[model samples]
Target: MNIDIVCVGRIKERYLTDAIAEYSKRLSRYCKLDIIEVADEKTPEHASAGVDRQIKAKEGERIAKHLKDGAFVIALAINGKQLSSEELAAKINDLGLRGTSHIQLVIGGSIGLDEAVLKRADYKLSFSKMTFPHQLMRVILLEQIYRAYKINAHEPYHK
Candidate 1:
């Protein structure tokens, strides 16, 4: 299976960059994992709701650029479906056997995803209802993906 994580903003912190690299390496044994970091939109302090929507739209456009044809799109959102590690592993396994050749997971910018982008998703996943920094979320996402693979393989690492 081929997986792509498309998100806004680069990982500026050394620790986060290192952690992401580690997960990426681990995931490589299971499938092709691609990380695409788009430049974050600038949000001025005290910005209006309209301005915020525009910012998200711009970021959405950039995220859309990395999407592959006929790929299954999964968006990470606060209100999305929350699944356990086992369930996520099952989902990944089922998807892998399905017709799709690629699975694209989207992590939106700080303000969240544009409705237009969310509408394109085949599945919306949420690890938690609580908020998290975009930078840290990337690391958490990668870890979960790696864990899911282990679970699917019935490897000792999952337990």
Candidate 2:
């Protein structure tokens, strides 16, 4: 499987970066994982709805550009469906069985994803209803993907 993570903004913290790298290395046994970081637009000092929309639009364009052709796109959003680890493993295996080998997981910036990106998604997934820092979400996502792989293989990690 080929997994691509298109995320807005870079991971500035060393600890987070290290953790992500660890997960990425661990994931190599299961699939090819690539993480693409896009530039995040600066929020205006006094922003309005229009400004926020414009920012999301710019970020969305950048995010969409990195999407792989024929890949199943999964956008992370607050209102997305919540699934258990076992369910996620099942979904991943099912996608592969159905011949959708490439999977693109998108993580938006602080303000969230635009409507266009959401519309293009094959599925919307939510880790939690509570808010998390975008940078931290990257690591969390990688860990989950790794966990899914373990579960699919009937490894002990899922327990």
- Computed on alpha carbons, the lDDT of every model, listed in order, comes to 0.92, 0.95
- Put down candidate 2 lDDT per residue, 1-159, tens digits, no spaces: 999999999898999999999999999999999999999999887899999999999999999899877999999999999999889999999999999889999999999999999999989999999999999999999999999999999888877
Residue 38 of candidate 2: its Cα lDDT?
A: 98
Model 1 agreement with the true structure over 1-159: per-residue lDDT tens digits: 899999999888999999999999999999999998898998999999999999999999998888776899999999999999999998999998886679999999989998988998999999899999999999999999999999998898986
Model 1, which residues run further than 4 Å from truth?
Answer: none
Whole-model lDDT, model 2: 0.95
| Strongest candidate by TM-score | 2
lDDT for model 1: 0.92
Best by lDDT: 2
Residue 30 in model 1: lDDT: 93
